[model samples]
Target chain A: MDTLNKIINWFTDGSSNKLSYHYFSRKFTPMAFIGPALLVMAILLVFPLLFSFKLSFQQWHMIEQASPFWIGLDNYFELLANKQFWNSFGLQLLFVVVAVSFELLIGLLVAVLLNREFPGNKIIRALLLLPIFILPVVSGLTFRFMYNPQYGAINYFLKLIGFNSIAWLSHPETAFAAIIIQDIWRMWPFMFMILFAGLSSLPEEPYEAAIIDGASRWRTFLHITLPLLKPTIMTAIILRTVDALKAFSEIFVMTSGGPGNATTLLSVHIYKSAFKFWELGYSAASSYMLVFIAMIFTVLLVRNMFSE
Target chain B: MHKFKSWSRWKKGLFFLTVFIILFVELFPIFMVVTTSFKPKLQIWTSKSPFELFRPTFKNYLQVFKDRNFAKYIKNSLIIASITTFIALFLGSLAAYGFARFKFRGNFLLSMGVLASRMIPPITLSVPIFILISEWKLLDTYFSMILAHISFSLPYVIWLLLPFFKGIPASYEEAAMLDGCSRQRVFFSIFLPLVAPGLVVAAIFTFMLSWNDFLYALVLTSSRAKTAPLAVSEFIGQFAPEWGMMTAAGTVFLIPVFIFALGLQKYIIHGLAFGGDK
Candidate 1:
C-alpha cells in the first residue's frame, strides 16, 4: 500500500517514494484539477496552431496535392509584394480604428446619459443588450437588407427626408463605411455596458470633491470622471480593437468583400484566399501576419488589464 | 425657488426624452426585423415607412418552418451550443480551481497562455483547423464543432471563472476536508455549490459564444452540421435575397438571444465587465 501510494505521488508531484499523504495531495491536486483543460487546449488549440505554422512555410493546394512540400519564404515573400494583401491589411487597420473609436465615444456618451436614475432605466439598459447578443449573421443580413438601395429602409428614409438614395454598399468607400456602421451598431452596447458598470462603481469622494470645488460639468468630466474611468475605457478599447481587426462573418455576409475588394478586411481576405481561391499556403501566411499584428495589441491589452 | 424647481423639472423632461430616443434607435433594427417578419410579402414591399404597422401574418415564418434544412440547422445549433457549454464549464472550472487553489509550477505561464489563446485570432486557426478536420474526416460532424468550440470557450471559461473561484472562501473547503473528505470531494460537494452562480454566468457566456459562432461553423461544417447562423447566411444566395424569409429567420435567431439577455442581464453585465467573450 505504501509503495503504491508512493508511485501515485511520484507521478503526480515529482516526489519520490518518500511522500507524505498531505504533501502529495497538496502539491499534486492542481494537476488533477487542471489536467482535462490542459489536454483540451493542447489538442484543439496548440496542435492546430503548430500545424498552421508548418503549413505557412509549405507549398501546396488542397485540391491539387496529396501533401504539402517545403518551400521556404515563398509564401511570406508573395504576401509582402501582393497589392491585394497590402490593401486588405490597410483596410483592416482603418476598420479597427474607426469602429473602436465610434463604439467607445458613443458608448461612453450613452453611459454618461443613462448613469443617473430615471424611469424605465433598467428596462432600457436591458434592451440595449439585445444588439450585443444578436448573432452576427442576423445583424449582417438585416443591415444588408436595410442598405439595399432599391427597396431598403435606409434609402427609403433618405427619400422621405428629400435626400438622394445612396448606394451604401455599392461604392468602395461607402462599402467600407457601411461595414463600420454595422460593427458599431452591433458592438457599442458592449462598450456601453462595460462603461456603465465602471461609472456606477466609481468612488463617490472624487465627485463630491469636484462638486465642492464648483467645477463646471465639463471640467469635472475631464478631470474627475475621465481619469477614474480610464481603466474601464482602456479595457473596452483593447477588446473592441482586437475584435474589430478580426471582423469577418458580418462583412462576409454584408458585402462579401465586394464592390471590388473594397471591404476586404484581413480575415475576409484570408477566407477568400483559402476557401474560394484555394491558396492555402498564402492564406495561412496572411493569417499568421494577422495574428502577429493582433497579438501586439493583445499584449498591450493584457498588460493594461493587469496593470491594476 | 419656484422658477428653479420648474427649470429642474424641464431638465428632467428633456433627459427622459433623450433617453427615449436612444432607446428607440437602439431597438430600431430589431423592431423592424420582428415587424417585417410578420408582415405579408406584399405589405413589406408597399410599406413606405419602416415603422408602419401592417396586418400581421405568419406566412414568412411558415415558409421558414416548412424548410426541412432550417429545422435541422436549429437542432444542430442547440446540440452544439449546449454540448460545448457543458464541456467548457466542466473543464474550465477545474482549471480555474487549480489556479485559484494551488501554487503549481508554471501556473502563471499556463494561465497567461490560456488568456493569450483568448486573444489569438480564430481566423488564423481556421485554415489549419479546416485542413486538419478534413484530414481526420471529421468535417460536417458534431465532434469537430464541439472540439473547435471547446478551444475558444475554454479560455473564456477559465478566465471568467477564475475570479469567481478566487472570490470563494477557502475555509469551506478546508472544513469539508477536516470532515475526512478528499480534496476533489470537497470541491464538488462544498465549493461547487457556492460557485453555482458563477458557473451559470460562465455557462451563459460559453453558450453565447458557441451559438453566435459563424466563421468556424461556416468553414468547418458543410451539409450535415450547419448551424442557424450559417442557415441564415444561406438565405442570401447567389442572386437577390429573400428578404421576407431572411427576416423571419433573423427573428427566430433574435428571440431566444433577446430573451436570454433580458432574463440574465445582471449576470451578463458582470460577466462582460470581467472581460468575458464578445
Candidate 2:
C-alpha cells in the first residue's frame, strides 16, 4: 500500500514527471485548439480596447502630427464642461428610454400572440425577422428615403390618410423621435423572439390551474405568464439597452447627429471626435467613458440574470 | 355568468386586435418598400397610391443592375457573408470544443471573456480598429470587414454552440474513442453530425450578422470592400439620397436577406426561441 501510494504521488508530482511525451500531448492539445482564437481576440479586440483605454488619459489631436501628450483626466473634465456633450448624453438617454420601452411593450404583445399556433404564423414570423437581417446602414438608407417629406413612402402613407409630411429626420426633436421609431421597427422583432422563447418555455401547469380556478385569462397572464417571463424580459432589456446605447450607424445615416446635435449619441460623438475632427485623445476619453457606462449596466444585468 | 362570458369575448377580441395592429405596423413598412420598388420612376416621387400598381415596371430592378453593376455588389455580399459564416462557425466550434472539453486554467474566464469582448460596443472599437486596418494598409479590402465580423460573430457561435455541445451526449464520442477513433475523428464523426441542426442555426445567424454589419465597412473600406449596404450608402451624399436610385438599391438589398431569412428561418427561429436546438 505504501509503494502504491508512492507511485501515485510520483505521477502526481509535476517536478518528478518532467512532463512526459504523453503528458505533453495531453496538456498541449488545448492550446493548439484555443490558442489562435484567444490570440486573435486578444490582439484585435482586447489589445485595441486596452490601448484605447490607455490613450483616453492622454491629450492628442491627429492634427498635432506628434505622439499624444499624456494629460490625465483633463479630457474627462473638458467633456464635463461641454454643454453639447451633456445635451447629446440627454438625447441618448431619451433615445434608450423611448426605444426600449416601445420595443418591450410591442414585442411582448407580438410574442404572446405569435406564441399561439395561428394562421400564417411562420410566414409572419419570417417577415418579422426580415428587418433583423437588414443591415443598420441599409435600414437607415431605406428609411431615409421613406421619411422623405415630399415623395417618401412614409409621407405618402400619411398623406393617403390625409396628414402632411412630418420632417421625420430634419426637425430637431422629431429627428430623435424618428430614429427611435425606426429603431423600434427593427428592434421589436428581436425582443419578440426572446419573449416568445420565454413564454413558450413557461410550464403550462400554473396556467391550467389558474383556468380551473376560474381565474380570467388576463389575470392568469398578469400573475403567471408575466412573472414567469421576467427573466426573459430582463435579458431582452439588458441586451437591447446595450445596443440602444451604442446606436451609431442608423443615427449616422439618419441625423448625422444633426439639426445641432439632436441625435448625437455617445457613439457619434466619439466618431466625430476621433475621425471627423481628429481629436483622438478626447474621443478616446469619451470612448472609455462610454465603455464604463456600458460595463456598469452590463454588470447589473448579468448579476440580475444569474441571481434570478 | 353572462358578465363573465362577455368579458371573455371582449378579451379574445382585444387579443386579435392587438395581433392585427402589431402585424400591420411590423409588416406594412416592408410592404411599402416592396410596392415602391416596383413603381415607375415618373410616379415613384409623384404617386401617392399605396395599392395601385398602374405604372408597375421592372425599371428599378433594371436600373439597379445596368446603372452600377449592382450585380457585383450582390456577388461581393454573397462571397463575403458566406466566407465569414463558414470560417467563424468552423473555428468557433473548435475553440468552444476545446474550452468545453479541456480542464485548463482560466477556461471559464476565457470563455466568458469571449462574451466580454462581444459586450464591448463595436462603435467604441471601430475607430481604432479602422486605424489598425488602415495601418495594416488593408483599407477598402474585404479582408478587414471579414476579420472584423469574425470577431463578433465567432463569440456568438461559441456562446450558442457551447450550450448545444454541453447538452449533447458525450458518451457517443467516448464510445467511438473505444472503437479506435481519435478524438478529432470522433468529433467529426459523432459530435459534428449530432449538432447539425444547431450548426445550421449558427450559420444562418453568423451570416446575417456579418451581412448586416455596416460601420466596419463604412470606416474600414472606401470602395474596394463596399458590401451591399455600403454600396447603397454611397448613393446618398450632402443632397437627398437620389430617391429612385435609393429605392432601386434598397429593393435589391432586401432580396438576399429575405431569401436567407426564409431559408434558415426554421433553424434560426428555433435556436433563438429556445437558445439552441438541444
Candidate 3:
C-alpha cells in the first residue's frame, strides 16, 4: 500500500513529474498513430512474403491433398530450364518497353500541346482522365469487341478506308500489338497527367531568358523544359513500368495468354501456374522472380524519389 | 497566351486541329462503348457502318439486371470498397501524420517500407493470402476480401497522405498545442479539416482500388463476395460475344468511376501531380 502510494505520487506530482510524463507521451504518441497500419502491413504483406519464400522451396500440388514436402531449389531450377517461363518473361519485357514507350511519347506530345491555353482546355483535360479510370476488364472487352474481324468497329473503319479487314487477336503478332495498343490507350493519360503537371509547375525564368536570347521554341523546349522535367519523367517511367509488369486483368480478359503462348506476360504466367495448373509451389517461385524484377525498379524509384 | 495570339492564322488553325485530333482519338473508344451499350442486338451484330444511326435501347441493361446477378456483385463491391476505404483512411491518415510530424527512430526506414510495400505485385501475395484465408476458413467471405484489399490500399493511402501532412505548417500545430488544446484535439479540429482535399483524394483512390480489384477477388472469393469486375469478366466466358450485354455491363461498371473522375477532377490532378513529385 505504501509503495503503490509512492508510485502514484511520483507520476502525479505536477511540478517534478511533468518532464517524465511528457517524455513518455512523446515516445508513445507516434506509435499509437502508426501501430495499426504496421500491424496490417505485417499480417498481409510481410507474413505473405515470408510464407511465399518458404513455399518456393517446397513442392505442393494443391490438388494432391498431400502435405507439401521440402524440395530445396527444385522450383528455381525448373524455372531456369522452363522455356515457357522465359518466353513469358521476354513477352513481358517487350510489352513494358513498347507500351511505356508509346505512352511516354504520345503523352509528352499531348501534355505539351495542352500545356498552353486553349478553348475548352479544362474539359478536354478532364476527358483525358476518363481512360485512366476505365476498368481494365472493360477496356479489354471493349477492345476485343472493336477488334472483331466481322462486324466490328475497327474492321468497319478499315473497310471504309479501303483496307482489308484483319483479325486482331487470332494471330500472335497482332494479338501482342493489339494488347500493347490497348494498354497504351488506357495508360497514356497517367503519364500525361504527371508530365502536364510538371510542365505547368516549371519555373518561367529559363523560358524568359530563352526568349531574350532569341532561342527557337524547339531549342527552348529541349534546353529548358526537358532537363527540368527529368525527375518527373523518371518518376513516371518507374511507376508505369512497375504497373505494366503487373498488367493482368485486361490481357487475361482479352487473350488469356493465348495464340500459342504469344502474349503470356509474367503475371499471366504466374496466374496460369497457380490457378490453372495448381502448381502452388512453382507459382510462388515464379511470383518471387516477378517480385525480384519489380524490386529493382522500386529500389531505383525510392532512391530517385528520396535522394533530394 | 501571347504566343497563341502572335501565331499565324494557319499555325493557330493547326494547333486547334491537333487538339481536336488528340481528343477524338482518346475519346473514340469510350464513345463506342457508351453508344454500343444503347444499341439493339441486331444493330450491334449487323451494323453496316460504325457510325450508323439507330435507336437506343436499354434491353441489354434489362437483360444484365434481370438475367445476370450484377446487382448483388455491385452490392458486394460497394460494401467491400466502402469499408476498406473508411478503415484505410482512418489508419493511413494517422500513420501518415505520425511519419510527417513525429521524429521517430525508424521514420525514414518505415516510410521506405511503406513505399516498397506499395510496389509489391499482388500476384505474389495472392498465393499465401489464399492459403492463409482458406486455412482460417475465411475464404469467400467479405472479411477475407476486405482484408486482402486493404493489403494494397493501405500502403497507397499512406504514401499519398504523407505529403499532405508534411505540407501542413508545423507552426499551426505548435500554436494549437500552445493553447489549452490537446494533441488529439489539434489533430481532429485543425489538421484533418485542413487536409480535407488530401483525405478526399485518398478515399477516392482507395475506393477505386478496392472497386477495380480482380485478382484478389478471383483467388479469395468463389462466389458470395465476388466483385463487379470479376462478375463482368465472367460474362465474357459464359457466352459467345454477347456484345450488347457486355457493353451495357461495362458501361454500368464505369458509371461510378466516371462520376468520381469528373466531379473531383481538380483534387485528383493535384494528388497525382503532387504524388508524382515524391
RMSD per candidate (Å) reads 3.5, 6.0, 3.9
| Ranking of all predicted structures according to TM-score, beginning with the best and ending with the worst | 3, 1, 2
Candidate that would win on lDDT: 3
**DockQ of each candidate, alpha-carbon based:** 0.55, 0.37, 0.58
Off by over 4 Å in 2: A1-26, A63-66, A157-164, B1-18, B271-278
Q: B1-278 in candidate 3: lDDT tens per residue?
A: 23676779999899889888888878888888889989999888888777899999999999888898789998999999999999999889988988999897999999989988888889899999998898899999999999999999999899999977888898988887667455555677889999997899889888888888999988988889999888888777635678888889888867877787788888888766655346
Candidate 1 C-alpha error for residue A29, in Å: 1.5
Q: Quick one: best TM-score, which candidate?
A: 3
Best by DockQ: 3
TM-score of 1: 0.94
* Best of the two (2, 3) by DockQ: 3
Error of 2 at A125 (Å): 2.8
Better of 1 and 3 by DockQ: 3
The order by descending DockQ is 3, 1, 2
B1-278, model 1: which lDDT tens digit per residue? Answer: 01223447778788778878888877888987898899888877666778777788888888887963588889999999999999899889988999999887899889888878888888898899999999999999999999888888999899998877888789988777666666666677788899999899889889989998999898899899989889888877878577788899888888778778888889988788776322
lDDT of 2 by residue, B56-79 (tens): 778777777888778887677778
For residues A1-308, write the lDDT of model 2, one tens digit per residue: 35533432343332223345247436665665667577777777887888777777887676765677888988889988988778877877888888999999988987776677655668877878877766788677677777878767777778878898787887888887788888999998988888877787788788778878999878888998898888778878877887788688877887788878888888888888888888787888787777877787767665764676
